[model samples]
Target: MDFLNYTEGVFATNTSGNDSLETTKLPTSKVLLTVTLSIVAILTTFFNCLVITAIAVTRKLHHPANYLICSLAVTDLLVAVLVMPFSIMYIQMETWIMGKVVCTIWLSVDITCCTCSILHLAAIAIDRYRAITDAVEYSRKRTGARAGAMVAVVWLLSILVSLPPLLWRHFSEEGDLEDQCIIIHHHLAFTLYSTFGAFYIPLLLILILYYKIYKAAQTLYMRREASRASRHSCMTNGSMIPSSFTAGDGDIDGGPRSPDPISPPEKSFSEPSTEEPPREKVRASVKAFKRKTRRPESRSESRRSQLYQGPRISGSRERKAASTLGLIIGAFVICWLPFFVKEVIVNTCGSCSTSVEMADFLTWLGYLNSLINPLIYTIFNEDFKKAFQRLVRCSNYL
Candidate 1:
């Protein structure tokens, strides 16, 4: 009996010690999570601020197109400042730190900012597509007022998508219900509505807009290449023409002229010609030959001018912008699709199982999209690139 009691005591002690050690390690993981969240928040704020500053300070970047970009940066900045910190706290604590009112506000801001960010992308894609395919019309119609209206509409739609949750969510007198800030994913109507509006609809629009943009861009490139090939052929044939002329200016008789019917009839007698070349005639012939020789050169210069001053140059710029937009769209989908998919699954399927940690990871991944948007949009832009260089290199001058 004594030996059995001793063994049980040792086992109990070991188990208690192990439990305490595990509890102690929990804070370490929490600290790591906190640090990671802080870093993400800082990066999101810093990069987005850089983009906004670059656009605002750079005079050339102050166009209707970049106005949309600035709006996107603002939305992302809000996510970093207003949404990310709260998100980090919730992730670490596994419960809401603020009260019900603050919780409601936070969720609203979260949805509003993310949805606004996404809508801005769709807006930008639309702008680029129009600019690519109907440049003259888009330039005529694109205005600050229109862009401002677009921004307003984006926020309004975001509010509509987010507000439904606030109506259904309530603070119950049960455990964690009052304290936990959660979107009421269990409500079937709100779930499908929010998910479809906030994600699915925007995704469909982006896909369609980008698809059209891609096709239009491809056609633009094909036309440009065809023009370039024709130009090259012209230049090549021009060079060969001169080479052939140097070999021989075909027969002096001006080759195979049809006989004029008004000429003397076939029976008319022809006198033997003893013609001598005159000095004035020789001078005029020399001048005319010189003009003809220079004519080919002048034509070549004109062709060169046309090659440089045609649709080709503008097409290249359009192609570059299209490629940049493509990259931004691709990155957006990659970052947000997973989180949106998870949200749809959890909300639409009542019996769906999801790990809390996995959900948190997906949420943060979507948040990281906000961080990347500025980098792709601004940094890849030539004007933005020069502006950034100026800002970094000539701060005092500005």
Candidate 2:
């Protein structure tokens, strides 16, 4: 989140002199900023906690895919609880009054949690792609243990990506650092590694996986629709045959008439007509049996309801794939891309620099992603919606 420049930009305000004076005389803008960021922190925590609670309480939402969501919510919850408040205080005070120990903890947790959140998105994209593209095989593969393992991997990678900054920043012996909590990254390579590992690479992977999922969803949906259409047509044509067979069963009248050999040539034709009733009965019986055995819900709906619980997952899903794909991609990119891009540019270009205000804006834009994550992940799921409603109702009752 351009945090390297971010610390400097914010701290630069107080680094000159008179930190105690500035902290006491808060500006209107800083007060407004504090209020705004405090609300953001509160909402971020509230929403992510709702997500975790919803997943935990709702048995219907207990699918392997949802496990990843719960983990993401946990990571975002950490961001809100552990990271955002400190950032807001820093913004308000314009200096690091907190001790070095707290700064070390804050910076480490900040990078780790944010990196974990981004990696969780990538993991979710992979799980959905597998479910859509390989439903049966993936169904077996997508278990609680597997989801746990995925979460573990995401956290491991996050820690690995964040470790360099945490270790280096913690051990730094730079003087006059008491007023600042900046992680001064001297090597450009670390910036590239951490940024790409934390945001860029995962986002690129998610985009590609979602694209593949979109195509697979389209194919499966069309196939299911065609199957339903063919079944409907067969039933429609069979309806007429059932009516004709009704009297054929009672052809006690027709059979008796046919046996009257007053015109023997007619007897032969009537005999063939009598046999047609048995064949029609078999066909009608088979159709009824098939209908009885068929599931109430279609395979497509069942599979997709478990997969993401987003939409129809067939006709409407196909039509809305672009929108869903775009929203997911756009939210993440809009939130994170500019900050990372700025980070790269500033790191690579010696003279290029971003103002503190611009850097803070970009950083918060990325932090907003923690709030956005739960909404995007859970809003479409009816199970989660119902669970949230129940929770809210219970909360009100209390």
RMSD of 2: 14.2
Instruction: Give residue 218's lDDT in candidate 1 (0 to 100).
Output: 64
Q: What TM-score does structure 2 among the candidates reach?
A: 0.77
In angstroms, the error of model 1 at 321 is 6.7
Write one digit per residue (lDDT tens) for candidate 2, span 1-398: 32466235533454456666665686776788889999999999999999998888778888889999999999999999999988888777676798888887888888899999999999999888777666556667888999999999999999999887777666666323787777766578778888888888998899899989777666555554444344344434443121111111111001211111111211111223344788776776676656545633443344334334332445566667778778888999999998888888887887788777787888899999999999998887777888899898885321
Candidate 1 Cα RMSD (Å)? 16.0
Tens digits of per-residue lDDT for model 1, 1-398: 00000111101112335646755778888798889889989999998988888888877888888889999999999999999888777666554557877866876788788888888888887777677666545666888998888888888888787666655554433224554666443555655677777777888888898888777656654554444546445565754221111111111112221211222222312222346357656666677667766865776676567656556665776777567767877888888888767666665665675555566677788889999998988776678888888777867433
Candidate 2 runs further than 4 Å off: 1-3, 6-11, 15-26, 171-176, 235-315, 395-398
Model 1 scores a C-alpha lDDT of 0.68
Q: Number of the top candidate by TM-score? A: 2
